[model samples]
Target: MNQLSTRTSPDTPWRLASLALAMLLSSLGTSIANVALPTLAREFAASFQAVQWVVLAYLLAVTTALVVVGRLGDQFGRRRLMLAGIGVFVLGSALAAASGSLAWLMAARVVQGLGAAVMMALSMALVGDAVPKSQSGRAMGLLGTMSAVGTALGPSLGGGLVAAFGWPAIFLATAALGLVAFAFAARHLPADARTAAPASFDLPGAALLASALAAYALAMTLPHGTPGTLRLALLLLSLVLAGAFFAVEVRSPAPLLRFALFREPGIGAGFAMAALVNVVAMTTLVVGPFHLARALGLAPAAVGLVMTAGPAVAALLGVPAGRAVDRFGSRRVLRLGLASMAAGCVGFAALPFSLGVPAYVLPLVLTTAGFAIFQAANNTAVVTAVAPERRGLVSALLTLARNLGLVTGASAMGAVFLAATGAASLAAADAAAIAKGTHVAFAVGGLLVAIAFAMTLAPVRAAAAVQGERA
Candidate 1:
């Protein structure tokens, strides 16, 4: 059997270091603030719902900018966009650190989100663009591990900093990290051909997506009993505009998202896998910690430690997963990973509320390991499936799916917890209710992952047939 090689050449080892650093910095920002949410709300005297916007605004902005920035990278160059992202992210961090009001903080977060969007979209695309396809799987796996490291470290780091200094320290630390990434990227990242294409920026589509995501995010953050009428209306409007945007893209010469990519089995299936993995991984990431800390009555520090299991396990398993994908195929690795994740979710559902820490920790580690394997395989499959010119858009869409999954899962869980508890705040009574609600959420998440597992099975079979015939 022949090795699958990326159309591009291998990057220097230093380039890989730069990629890892950029990913780590971006991911650290993704969840670091989460651990500091309570402090942020208290400091600003913001309500629970109002405080959610701090997170929501970032998601909305990132979703809006993802495809647009990615397209620009394909046209201009990946390294350029990465550097720009670092600069913009650092500026946003400065703004966030200086902000005194909630509104200002949200606005600052949006800037950071846009910067993150640029980095994330281009980073994934450049990995494929710069490396041999044979090595791309391992490269992507390493990158994914860096992401896991950032996420795993964020909570504990944020909590420690908040306990010592304040929320502003989180921004400062991330800014410093971003600066280091920028310098490394500037020195080591390889140059790509900046081809000018007929594909100009899709401003109209960008506007539509931005408006839609903003509305949807706003709906998610609206406090319960705060008149669902307005929220429902905004959500409905978002749906309508999203439909229009799709129609326009279908007819446009250069669509923001190349819909044709969906026709490819590997690309489409990989994206579905990405979404499903996020649904399971994020549900565990967001709810598990919240439950352990708030529901199970564990200390905040202990909760952070428990939460660390998933990413830690993923980081450890990432390289092996990448090697398997590169040698056999991503489809097989993805299927196995999804199955493991589903089993972990089932474990979560069956565990008694009074289950010991070890029981819970085992499942957490398994689920995280599955997520790591899935991410590494899926990223390689998606980027390698497409041409170099189109990688950024595909990578952007993949990143968008991951973020949207987190946004949707977190919002849905928050709503479910609120409905179950029937209380304005999280309390001891609310803990039991939240635990029950989480079981249902885990079941649903498991089902979602199972579907992806099923989807990947057929693709693996098909790809194997093609490989066999060629052999």
Candidate 2:
């Protein structure tokens, strides 16, 4: 059956299976490590701030390298690069599992992140390659489910492994899964056709963009206690580098990012909405565990299970959401997604500790379901609008924007939590403090959704009247 992939059509389940696994691995990498943050802090005799880099290193690495790697896939071959990516991920996972010190672990995570970036960037474009345009929505939906599974499943899975065999078991299991993903990818992914116009790699643009993203992500996600002046400097530097990047892109004949392309309705609006939604959604991933563990006094295992509620909703609804996009339209479904997310934010803002986990779980699930629906519609619209040659880069950009949101959420929301609680550390934060922090964070998240809604409103409304708007 594996050998018959060349003879098999693009619509086969196997093609999507490989892409699904890649999405799963990449998504799980962050949250799984998140679940182990406390353990890592204890094991390495480090502070919460120092140990957080275990998660940030991977995100930073992925965020910085995503576009460059995506372009390389476009110029070279997506299948070949994807194979290399899986191998690198597996190698890094093994190294992480065997790391002797916190520094070594963080370094290994960077390596893992680089590979995960390729997996995420390429797996998305590969879905376009593997499926016909008509089925892209459904295929993307399934990919969304796997990503949801990874995100939702990570805490429970990591918790179980940590309980049974300690922190390293998480990476070991991830590495083993990587091997399986590799095997499927090798057998099922489509080989790239030689391009008539070869990709012109934009070395300067890539460097500037990577630097800007790194600076921005670092400034946003940097743990508190850093000198405020330093964080401000990094933020200012990031803005300068970003301006320089755009300046360079405007000049480069073959730019890394196409500025003119983003002017279109679907592309611009889709990117903004995706980023905002992720920024809002990340609060749950970063803050929910603390609320559950400290505010509600749940154990580690219970925290993991409770955390699964939202992601489980995401996974369950992803396919249906995609089908709805196919049957209705992206704009309509996208609006619904935004509405659900807003309502979820409102729910979280008023969450009461006395009601226990169910109160938290219900809102969380609603938010996650909205995320799944939004991605299915927004991603499908964006991918279909771009040319085949540009799909990989566009796909990478979407993933990059989403990554930016996640890191921003982790850092800013964590900061908000810390400030609201008035605690020096999570260890010191009590039920009342945690409750206050969670409410504050969710309130901020809801406000962001309002902003996102404003940005998206013009485009979706224009899309209704403009004959040129892509679905």
Candidate 3:
């Protein structure tokens, strides 16, 4: 395999800024669209299940395409892939804004997801490519901060836009941001030098992986009332397809995802930690708004404000956390982060027994801060673990783990909430029932975070041992 050369030096600030802007736009688009779901449902006279495809389609498309697109970036050029992705994403946003029907909107979202996948896969890789290893933790922290800001602003911005203008305005705004990002990226991002190795795209491996991911996403997205047998079948199919994907990858000379990457010390653990943190943190994204609206009687704007607390705190802490990781090492920072997150989850689970709305904010802030610390350190660790040439692939794996966790965690926690409340839908539940359901979901999330906290110990010890021997 041949290595590619980057046009920009590792110390250039322009490269980091451009990459950060692109990441913010991509993440902002997802969160903004989520805020428009109910409005879209009302405007199209569609069922909740149908309107949900707007989000689901995007996620499915992105998740399925991540690995393949990442591999393509490594083979071609990361900058080239990023520019193309931004162009496609802008186009998709324009189409979504002009959509005439629910079906058209969902299809456009799938396009957006594809473009987002390309951007997501390459953003961190590009950062790693441009920044020195010693400074990577801080770079990852800054990038993570941009992501948090996007997420933080999404609900409030989307809600205001929807209330004042319409749902279409949300997409239009995103498109306008994309255009700005495109201009910045084009001017600032350096071109990648091509490798001398033969270019081989793993078509079969891509297909199998896509099938497995799509099957699993579909299974999870099915309506709560759907037949158990059908869901079972889809799950089984997903497992089979996943098995097939591994088989294909092992035989292929140039695989979409290299299995050997996982064998690197702490790489697999980093992926697991990524997934687990998202699983614990994303509960707010999926369940918090409904709890606020139905149980707490907060309007959309108020709910957005309340929900913004977590991301806001995360964004504020991100840069500092990165610097901490750079100074203290990833293992120590990671353990501290995991512990903070678990404690936050415990507090979040007990919100129903607390005084009022303000009580909820503290736990969210703590959890978000923990997320920032963990992500910055873990991302740096993952990027540094792999060879520079394979950064794109490792970045995609990290993203895949997070997306998988988002989908699975949202589905599982939603189910738990529904079952606990015994309500067909959260919107239909009374305050008491919603409170009960929220407690159950948060309790489950807390438990999962605790498990993740425990899991961090082994990897931390292993890393310490390696450093000791080297020393």
Candidate 4:
């Protein structure tokens, strides 16, 4: 196998920009679709549950395909997979824009998700490949910033597009952006060198992993009032499939995910830390809006403005945080970031007793800044820990961990809110009830983050020791 060189290439800037654009488009697809949900429901005269499949199907497809596609990129070429992904994504967007029915739209969304999986899985790995280790943190940070900015831009852009031209305009716009990304990628990305002896692909293991992830995501996405027995059955089935996947990987010549990677120093910890931070960060995205609109008596526009503050702060600080990671090393920066997040969580929990929007926004900004810092540092650590050949799988695992965290965190917090408010629907609850539920949910999220903070110490020490040995 031809190892990737450590020397900085001349085309590094353009390569990074191309990868960043891909990341932005992937993030934009997600956020933009969210804003169109209600409009889609009304247009199709479909039930909310049916309309929700649009989002759920996309998510499931992406989650299922990430690991498989990442492995493909590793074996073939990241540049090839990425270019194909963009082409497929653009095609999916066009199909979605021209869909005649809800089912067709949902199917097109699945195609979009399949394309997005390739882009997301290869994004970080491509960065690790193109950028030298010494400067990787900055590139990863920039990519993270682009992702945040894309997500932040989505709702506003989607709303505007839908209002002026209709929901189809959203898909058309995404397709246009996809075309631009494709052009940049084709012009800028370096070609992948072929391996001398490519290992056989693990088709069975891939199937097992896909099945496990799909089952779990479905269970998580099921309606709030879904039958407990049915949920339990799905959970059990997922566990069984996961166990089978593990067994297959243990024996397979080329496993879908090499379990040995986790044995690497600090890699496992980095994955855990990534998942925990996302769990806390996603709580704000999923639950905070309801609290703002219903509990705090803010208008929809006011809620959007307030929520934008956190991501905007994160976007502004992302590159600086990356620079900090490079200067101070990832461990210290990661610890500091986690500490800030914990503090922010505490502040969020206290918002019920506070006076106004400033109180809420301040804590959110703090939390998001910490998340930004943590993401850059932790991503740097995880990618750097693995070998060049394994970076694609590591990237896919990191993305999977994040998706799991987001889904699990949202579900857990939703349950907490329901329990605290003693109401079936968030909309049914009055301001006092919403406030009470928000407090409890934030408190729980804070406690989880505190645990992650403590868990991170050992990995930081391990990483420090390795760096010292190298020095």
Clashes of each: 2, 0, 0, 0
State the lDDT of candidate 3 residue by residue for 302-360, as single tens digits.
98778878888889888899889889888778878887887787777786633567657
| RMSD over all Cα atoms, model 4 | 2.0
TM-score-best of 1 and 4: 4
Worst 10 residues of 4 by lDDT: 1-10
Predicted structure with the largest TM-score when compared to the true one: 4
TM-score of 2: 0.90
Tens digits of per-residue lDDT for model 4 on 1-471?
223346677888888899999999988887889888999999999988889898888888888898898888888888899999999999999999999999999999999999988888899998876777778889889988998999899989999999999999999999999999999999988788667777899999999999999888888879767898887888899999999999998998777787877877778877787778888888898778888888888998899888999889889988899999989888788888888888888888886544778778878988999999999998888887777777888898888888888877777777887788878788688888887887888888888888877877776566578776421
> Which is the winner by lDDT between candidate 3 and candidate 4?
4
True-vs-predicted CA distance for residue 129, candidate 1, Å: 2.6
Question: Candidate 2 has which clashing residue pairs, if any?
Answer: none
Colliding residue pairs in candidate 1? 5-133, 6-133
- Expressed as tens digits, the lDDT of each residue in 1-471 for candidate 2 is 222313437446888888999999999986798879999999999999899999989989999999999888888888999999999999999999999999999999999999999998988888767866667778788989999889778877998899899999999999999999999998988777766777678999999999999999898877667888988999999999999999999999988887877798768777887888899988998899889988999998888678777778889988898889878877788878888888888888896878998888878877888888888988888877877777788899899889888878888888898899988887888899999999899999999988877776787567778776553
| Error at 357, model 3, angstroms | 2.4
Global lDDT of each candidate:
0.79, 0.86, 0.83, 0.86
Give stretches of model 2 more than 4 Å off.
1-11, 35-48, 162-168, 293-301, 351-356, 417-434, 468-471
TM-score of each: 0.89, 0.90, 0.91, 0.95
